[model samples]
Target chain A: MVEFKEVEGYDSLKSELKSLEKSDKPVFVLFTGSKDSSGKSWCPDCVTADPVVHASVKEKLSEGVFITCQVGPRDFWKNQSNPFRTDSKLKITAVPTLIHWGQSNRLVEEQLFKRDMVDMLFED
Target chain B: MRATLMTAMIRTGAKQCCPYAACSSSRSVAYYSKSAIDTNSNYDLVVIGGGSGGLACSKEAADQGARVAVLDWVAPTPHGQSWGLGGTCVNVGCIPKKLMHQAALVGNHLADAAAYGWQLPKDHHVPHDWNTLKNAVQDTIKASNWVYRVQLNSKKVDYFNALGSFLDSNTIKVTDKKSEKTITAKYVVLSTGLRPTYPNIPGAELGLTSDDLFSLKKSPGRTLVVGGSYVGLECAGFLKGLGLPVDLMIRSIPLRGFDQQCANLITDHMSGEGMNILWRCSPLEVVEAGNDQKKVTWLSDDGKKESQVYDTVLWAIGRQPRLQPLNLQAANVQLNQKNGKVIVDDEERSSNPSVFAIGDIAQGRPELTPVAISTGQLLARRLFAKSSRLMNYDMIPTTVFTPLEYGCVGLSEEAALKKFGEDECEVYHAFYGPYEYTIPHRSSEQCYTKIIALRDDPKTVIGIHFVGPNAGEVTQGFAAAMTCNITIDQLQSTVAIHPTSAEEIIKLRITKRSGLDPRAVGCCG
Candidate 1:
């Protein structure tokens, strides 16, 4: 069985990850920029990568918990000391970063737009 | 007296020079002519230092199927601090220093956050925690040490955690804590690097060197950094950035051999950032004060005596090659009388054809890690893989990670003017503000860049210097361009990455010879 979780910010993502830490199934996480009231993300690359990543995750992940994370607003992200960038475990340099949680498998920035790389991240 | 001291230093393997040019004593020559011992050759190569140079040479030779053994040992500093196998750079020098610099940069960003429209609670200020920052830096260093160890093991290179002293040109005496062994190689390499030197003053042992600062158990309170070497300035810069009261004392000009104009700008920016710089000063003595403090007494150039108590005093006077224990005399290796480092030919070959020296221990070579690594690999390739490419010592890029980082390649402005006369050289310069600094209204008075070239048609770039954020990153591509013999016309013709500090180099037009101001113009200029 597969489960899906949507996380809003870094704090809630930490709590959500804590609950999934002991799950037997694998975990996949996709981090993107937060959307506005019009549902348009401030990051152009994330807006372009969202549907492609979500579709690839649904098609390739047969039995893992897929996590869709909204990192923060543009202002928060621009602050060089933001938590997402500073956290040693998740030193995310840019949004639209997809990770095969707990593994070194990751696709960052434009890598998320490549269908083969996205499928490989989910399948591998 | 100075000549006597120089002769004694040469005999003892210290790099201190004789004040006079009268250092050609017969006694020094007699010291290194020890008779050779008979031994059977056991390996193709034996490297005596496990630093960047030695490790790279050993690994490259091993990859070429040469039987190699690396002997490395870290002697404790005066303060009893010792580290693992990756040498001064990974343990005490670059890695830890850059990480700490980053920590200070983070503090600056946090201070600028409010101007970027980020809200903070009233009266909410977080003090920098030295312990946390130290732990993070140390962790990275530890991991690198382990990785280097694993890499050596996987490469099939014999690793000996012991001190190697030369018995002859081909034989080495290796000694560990509990065992002693003898090994011989067809060729020998000396890359022992250097150690920080303390001034020849009374009670000098009380001060800490860079080797001991990285692993200090507690925070360094109000600090006094002695000397104006790049090491001294960098230590003072980072300490001040971390919100500590730091005083930098210099006996002469800061960064003696670098571009003096750029060096002055660095000092000026640091002064504006609240670092107290005491110029034309030299320390005479250091004595312990009560309650974990030391008082430094000094005489200024203006004939005044001054004393101040500091919780930490760092001695970054200079460095000496770690050759004392190696017993190079037994191998008949020659040392330059002027500077006590090993005398090597253009090919890095020492006085003895079978022996070589690289990195800091080699005379007249740039004491940089990348230079060491590249030369080591090239030497290994020539010796083991039959490659003929020589390591080019020209136009090598380097960065000093200060509060306002400085990165430069090729000759300095002074060197360019000296090499090519003032009438034959041209200098293009600019002082510009970074786009990111606008929100915080940060001062960009010291964010500067310079390009030096010949005044002839299609002037060949002789040098590039930049002092701004991410100076190293900005100067790297330019360094590559220099290697290709890039010309000033090509630089001007290339389109630049918009709104970047780096693009300022490509867009440079105002020359120092021109009477026009070199300050920044508005956007789209």
Candidate 2:
């Protein structure tokens, strides 16, 4: 079964990634917007891609670690100096970015909404 | 049955009543009939101009299962400067301007770091590198262009890197260097935005606009910025911040359409920062001098004519909608002749029922990136998803990234007084020092905040204005509060966060009408 983990903000995301670096299992990262007061992501694309990504992971390859990283509120994400954008290893430009950690495989924006693309990225 | 009737009407070239009563032209009927006949049309929506508004609308429409196509083309400036996708905000206006403004602030911080006890070499001269800063800003813009392209592709929105013009009511012709193609769509959105205009005078073409400033190959030295608009002040401010000599000439008022009190404070701050300001001066002519320099002559308010030579002359007079080449008339779209912008109703719909407008191209709306993005998204949802949410144009927040940033939302004090009448308006203001400014002995006299409220009991807040560091960040939350009709009592009752500039809003206790000094009295409130 796939093990899911959730973290908030850039500091927590960095720490989570660091802990997973030494793991033997393949790591998959989904960077999204933090929930607002209503418990829904302010980013529309993240709202659209969440259910699909979550359900697909449970149905498909279930051996790896699936991590969801909330990148904070709109103001924090809009700031160009946010480490998620400036960091060389991450360089995330938009929200709802899915990555097969340490691999060239990644999907951004509406690409995360594509079932076939999401399934392909999760393949062992 | 309707499809059959539409096909018959098209084949017979007969006039048919359109489903939308707003569409009066026979061309509209023909276009609607054609779409009905060909269910597999080229696209359901065609958005011309891939700027902030157009891109957002196109992507949202596609997400709602509409086949959308976006056409974008950047015309080179007179100085032969052009850029990739993402339009003015990314390439020239907002993104690069803010980055350079941040660079200027960092330069000031470095200078002030010495007062804060950061050890430095005695004669260390840290010269600003124009090329380095320009390259970094351009690199980010290029990355944004790639991301926008990727986003369109992933959303299944067709992207065309060509200039598009209306061929007919339903058809559009797009042309690039390599090829030309015509596309048909059921709906069209015009978000072509705006381009800077130069003053009509001798050798005016020799000067550059904001379009060329961000991507200029060399540093703009000894610059002469003509006009009193926000763009002019911002350019002059940043150039001065980077240790360059700048001369700013204003025709009349500085920052027209804004609160005069606040505008004067901004100019005062700019003058104190060592920028040369010539009020009531209008440019008469620009003559080409040797070595790529230009000689600018202007007429002072007293009718005295003066001439000076400078390495660069930038014109920030104004911008007009990019509607000349779009052939809007052919599509039956109405234009506001006074401003050259498309006349859009509250629904963002133009004269033609199937045609809509947004962004700078749309009349009577703030020319802001966030405003455009929100309007475009709301428009798409209404069109495709059957949502009836109309975009609220009121209480929209905007930031002017000057030497000391200025942010405001809702009405200005002057506007509020005029709207609510002088007897029914109350203005509360304060000037406080930021915590960081005290250590460096920086003067906080120019850091000002004001709230305009109704004079009645409870005093419902109508507007908020802020001028200081990170003014945009400070004003944003207040804008939301204004939308909620926050009252002075509610604002004052809110708990304050210590040691931050934003907390000053809640701590306001003095009214401007009291004729008392609004300056801070003690460090702790």
Candidate 3:
């Protein structure tokens, strides 16, 4: 029998870039959902793109810092929202987005994908 | 530091790895790794849902020498995906529904048995022992299940009787709805098919869904069917044919977004079948009328509540994925929040990358059984590395099993009109009564073919919607054409077999209503 540690949940503040300041690790932040009025290309995981965003982060940077920001129906699950911001920083847009935040909680880089593009994204 | 990780990922995805475990993770890492790593359970492939896709996936894997297991929840024997192993299309959904409707259509022919100058035996009162007929249908399902079980046994595939859910990516939990067993595999193919949705409407539970109605006992004296789409029409129509007084209520317009013209014709024919149609009406509640009857209360367009006395209430609104108990999340598979469908890549991989899903669970564009079967086959071939490339999902066609029957390949007129514009779109329609019914002048013998082609680019037939006789069976070949991206000219140039509803496809011409070049559209000429 395997004894696994229960994954704990985070308290809600608001999911902003600044939330990464709390953790020492430089986290990979992913924002995902429907297309905005500005007409961004969309991938309809609808609201469920939250876990997907984190999964993609775990994909490329397995041990790298990882955090998630979601913009949709406000009744976000207990741990699914951000620790700093609630409403979106940018107007709501495409899904499964990977936003790389560097030290000091500043935005570093971000990207979206239609199919398998890990090679393209991470390749120097 | 980031640059190094990025370069590593790039090289990781592109560089060929050794045939050992780590490189095996790249080649078979997606779904197969889980299947491959599970040594406790001797089976490499164990499919839980015996619907069309499940059967195809398991049977093919077994053919490839993988120890396989297939489980289904269908009772009186699960014949659906078995195809004998063929799956639901042959056993329940398509085959039996079409056969039942065909039997009803023959009712019209029996009326004219004397016109052909044949000596009448007891005035052609066709014997329809409802109990006996129902049993006969169930018998076919049983025999098909037996055949499937026999085939799987011969092929050395374990056939379990249970509903299979995920214990983990590599482990499956099978509950016979009685006994439960947990088995693990290296890979899992989730193909548990869809079931009718029971939305939280008042008295919703009182009504029977299509599954219950199909295997029902005594026919209701009066049946109230709610839902405007094919399921509603089919259930009501079948009940009416079985001599049940049927009233069909549609809250919205009929057929929802089907070709407006075809929807209207279907409504007309449903009324002609002695089935009452309550347009712009919906069931609000259901109450009991003694033990054997039900009182269905419905509201009209004007918001007036009317009491309806029905012996049975069949709710045929829509179908949603039946994946909750399947425990996809345990396997790191994610389902679309807006719909119960799963998130899948073009190859049908879940976000986890260890599992693959198809059919209702795979959350692709189409949700028909045939679509599921196609995806299952494609996934098997791709995962096993048998195929050179992946499956194409464009232009998949499907049909409805209504009394008048409707089949559509590609886009509808409404979608076409929206995409291409009314001015740019054209429809070629042909009307005919099958020659077999024409001599006696059965005017309702109305069968029509509709070909939707872009006006400027008329050579490409974007959609083909056929209604009337043999719509389901005849549409298959045409659907195959559309799957291959067959143009209008290609469809027209094909030789047609005569005295058949399929011939109407080749007989498409400029509709009596509108524009075309001087040349007739049909190829036979």
Predicted model with the maximum DockQ: 2
Once model 3 is optimally superposed onto the true structure by TM-score, how far is the C-alpha of residue B321 displaced, in angstroms?
2.6
Q: What is the TM-score of each candidate against the true structure?
A: 0.77, 0.80, 0.70
Candidate 2 lDDT tens digits, A1-124? 6778999987887888898888888888899999999898999999999988987798786698898999999999999999999988788999999877765457888888887567756762
Return the candidate ranking by DockQ, descending.
Answer: 2, 1, 3
lDDT string, candidate 3, A1-124, tens digits: 1111111122231333354467554445454432446644243453344344334444555344444444333233223344323434332233344443431112111323221232222220
Say which docking band candidate 1 falls in: incorrect
Please, what is the whole-model Cα lDDT of each candidate in the order they appear?
0.86, 0.86, 0.63
Give a tens-digit lDDT track for model 2, residues B38-64.
Answer: 664687799999999999999998887
Fraction of true contacts kept, per model? 0.00, 0.07, 0.00
- Considering the true interface contacts (CA pairs under 8 Å between chains A and B), give the fraction that model 2 also has: 0.07
Worst 10 residues of 3 chain A by lDDT: A1-10
- Model 1 residue runs over 4 Å out of place are A1-124, B1-39
